[model samples]
Target: MSPGPGADSAPAPKPHDDDHTSGTAPGDGPAGRGTFSSLGIRNYRLFFTGAIVSNTGTWMARITQDWLVLTLTGSAAAVGITTALQFLPMLLFGLYGGVIADRCPKRLLLLFSQGALGLCGLTLAVLTLSGEVRVWHVYLVAFLLGMVTVVDNPTRQSFVSEMVGPEQLRNAVSLNSANFQSARLVGPAVAGVLITAVGSGWAFLLNGLSFLAPIIGLLLMRPAELHRTEPVPRGKGQLKEGLKYVAGRPELIWPIVLVGFVGTFAFNFPIWLTAFADKVFHAGAGTYGLLNTLIAAGSLAGALLAARRGSSRLRMLLGAAALLGVLEIAAALAPSFWLFAALLVAIGMVGLTVNVTANSSVQMATDPAMRGRVMSLYMMVFVGGTPLGAPVVGWLTDHYGVRVGMATGGAVAVIAAVVIGLILLRAGGMRLKLDLRRGHRHVRMVPRERLTAVV
Candidate 1:
């Protein structure tokens, strides 16, 4: 049923090439390496280290950018617009960017993309430090950086298997999430202090400098050690081919749809959190940073837990999404700031569960030849909806108040989870039943093929 793109067009892979499986079990070569197995590979180690530096800088920039936008305009809608601009390019070119990743040398492409991103950061830094930064300046740089990310995001995702073969891909993906979460924990706290002590300019400048670590790491990677796949040859209708490829697979399409809904409506944390800090809590940047750090703390734990698991399953994904939605709703109704913050930790954990499971499932289910395209489609839908949703969510928060805004996202998420879950259940030819016998009650979804219905 995995009707992927034309695998016949792809050349036979080398012996050292990746095995196209969802990386659940440990690979024979690295069975002894344990949970940190991906780090044992020299190339993955280099990439991982570099990623840590860059991701930290990215988080710093994110906090600074949102705060700066608010400071300049005093409008949540303006902040939302900034977020929208950053992701708008991905909505436009993300699929095409995946095609480019498949056709080009990923390592080389990353070098250029990373360099461009750093330059954008630096330009923003200079403008801010000189007191010449305007709202347009922020908007322009966000869009430019996002344009570069259109290329960078999918390439980086597909590049993981190159650094660590498919056997370790699941572990690698989990570790990568952990790394990013780790950065989330540190970057926001640091950005807060720096913003208070100096200004947003220094945070931008440091992030610009952080790019050098990845650039240097890329240069240091051993080309021969990489488990490289041959680039897809240039051909007409490749993008169409990718769409058709995903369309044929239920496993691929379902998660993407589920994530698309969650990402669009529920993942507007920047808008939600900032409004809470400014409006509800009536706090400063430090409190906002604290809010971020708590979520990151929970997310970090969730990532570690995911790393411990050998496989990501569909049940995990659905359950996590449902839990996340419920928690989000609960958080929205919190009577106090501390209660809301505590709920954030649980929200972070459930959110990561959905993310890690969906990501691992898609990558594992996809064929090697079509990994880039599938992942690009994954990124496009999963992230692309942000541009369309952020502004709307921002407007809601601006007019209806933070609680209503949060509640709106929460309600949408819960509905999406229930709808997607029912669709998947029926697709599996099953129906849920509630049974009460001997004063005990239970509920379950039974397979239609196995059931005898009483008339």
Candidate 2:
């Protein structure tokens, strides 16, 4: 189950690595720690450029949507419902989505998904601009958008191989995380200003426009240069097979399990943040922008830190989870909005670090042929837990208060980390060995206990 370590390959920037048509250079080349080059293919530059533009816009839409709902009805439960509708499809159809991902052309799938998402954005924009937006309309659109995301995420993940080839895959995944986090920094602030100025509706309109970047990249990509996975026709046992493949690997299992809990609990920061600003923080939309920007500032640092460590190790992942847990706890207890925002910066940094580590580690360890299935499982756990867990947090916030709900979530995250650390060390037959003399290269190895799901 433990795919081999990706230590031999340095993650690189896409543009730098793509031009070398010759096969991988044998070991002595200076390895990159954090750029688009990891995949040895340079074209990821185009991919990265497009993604950077798109992701920031997406974040803007998300914050605006949440803020709008809070404005319209003042119902936290409704926000929970909106969030749940968006994510519930992943729990229901994510595995099948994975099966399709392994078989589909990722670029084409992305095109269709992006198109659908853009249309939804446009619809939302029109509704908002007309001053006719309704809670029910938002709910329905959220569900539709979620459906598109279910298709988009898996295809996008599996497509990484095509952009950079197998050699730079680990680095590619890590760098991509950095890109996503980087966009996180800019997007919220922009959305905050726009929301407060023109209104939340304009933010949606802009998101619709941002889709152009990726569409352009896709169109411009040289078809002949791509590394495509062969399509697999649907069969009776495909979904089960993908599940069995995941069930077999402890390296994969523990990371996904940990992320499921942590991502689910910690990611509700958006909901908690709006509450904090309105309730405890007593800030307006502008402060909401600052809060988000501050967190992204921490995340940008985290993504950069992750980029340095050449390999994704179990120890780094666990450490991040544990640190983030502490920060989240502090955030919930903060006496002032400024203090809470400061805590959020640290929370975001550690959160992104853990996320990138887990995401890169799992992607690197999975078989190329089964990569889609594994990545789908990873996404499903990370996002699926949101629908399941967010509602509970929302309910807690609605009744007990945002602080209580967030604190509980942080506590749960800490417990999840502790448990995962134990499982990896004991039952998973992993040993912790740290090499501080060098950068943090410590790792857990489980060759003997590894599970093979190909059968």
Candidate 3:
């Protein structure tokens, strides 16, 4: 998920679902309470803490779901197909989801979505525990879960600003990433142990039960603390107007493009890991979980860094993208299991840096009126890119070998850096070059007129 970007001095609402009230007040921020400490706010604190607990279960369920499918089917293709099904709805419904989010009461909408997710988790647990589960059952459940996510993602994103206001929006978003990534770390490891001990069914049950936290958080929040908006317009112009607004700004457009490219192409750690543990290393589920753990650990650290640096910078984001590519290649060449895990940690750190940074930049830069639509675009590419890349990546692993497949993605990422950097430069009305000879990469983001006149 992307954090809303920019607006450093004031925490302002992003384009919100008109129903949310971003309740900013006199001297609200200077009291050391809004942005950095919005978590300290009465309403947001409850919601944030609740989110942390809920997110852990969500990650746990995802890990178990993938593992369960793989264990029963023993087919990588099945995993890929199911993963594709889970995300395909995002690609198809993202725009519509944005529309729904922009028009609905985000809190109320989230209540329903979270409940659906819990029920989905419970149903999966029951079916799987019964030992009557089949491949199709997993697929159907995954598809339903994906459908719920289509409704859930934008609403949840748009809801944060309502609770914390725009002053603390960046921090709230960063903390949210931190929360999700922290959950990512706990969920997978716990799922691994549980799957190896009690069974995957229990993990699903835990996830189902976890939804209660967020549901309660929603019920407890004070609407007076939220940013208020006029009634939602059902105008046919909503989508078109939002797209036009997004297309018009360089601050916003560049970051969205950056995230779209990187998210679609580079941040595919899960599918790539399957190849690492199974094909290249010829290992099993334990090794797979360990690899994910290493990556999640790195990502958790990256989230922390982003949380501290609440401002957005395009140069920083691009630099992270470049570093992420370099690490991908390094991970591919890791000589042993332990070394590979170490490299994966580095890969995860840099990958999350790319992810969190790009996400923060795009979300912050977008217009408040169109945040839902813009975020949907961000997520649509981030998740949608998987369906396109996974099958191809899986095929490459199957045919060309895992090392080559991993290397291929890394190489593409590197090429993307050079290409995207130039694209951003040219689009920014500037020409730039990167120098790495001084034992560090130094890039100067000079203006177009200055660079052109120099030549």
Q: Top TM-score: which candidate number?
A: 1
The TM-score obtained by model 3 is: 0.88
lDDT of 3 at 304: 76
Residue lDDT tens for model 1, 1-455: 01122222332222111211112322323342366877989988998899899999999999999999999999999999999999999899999989988888889998999999999999999999999999999999999988998989889888887777767888888889999999999999999999999999999999999999999999998887787777788999999999998887666788899899888888899999999999989998999899999999999899888877776666578778878888988998999998999999999988988888888778767766787888888998888889999999999999999788888887888888788878777666666666666564466666666654432
Question: What is candidate 2's lDDT per residue for 1-455, written digit by digit as tens?
Answer: 11122222233222112211111222112466545456355467777888899899889998898889888888676677788888888877887778877777677777888888889999999999999999998998988888887778878887876676655666677678888878888888899889878998899999998898988888777656665556555678877887787677666677788899897887787678778877776677777778888888888887777666666666667778888888888888888767887798888889888888788767766666677777888888898778888788889988999989889888888898887786666653444443444454444343334522221
Report the candidate with higher TM-score, 1 versus 2: 1
For candidate 3, lDDT tens digit of each residue in 189-279? 8887888889888988999999999989888877666664332468888877767877776555666666666666676666677667776
Estimate the lDDT of model 2. Answer: 0.75
Give me the displacement of residue 288 in model 3, in angstroms.
2.0
Cα RMSD for candidate 1? 5.0
Go through the candidates in order and give each one's C-alpha lDDT.
0.84, 0.75, 0.71
Order the candidates by TM-score, highest first — what do you get? 1, 3, 2
Clashing pairs in 1: none
lDDT, residue 390, model 2: 77
> What are the models' TM-scores?
0.92, 0.87, 0.88
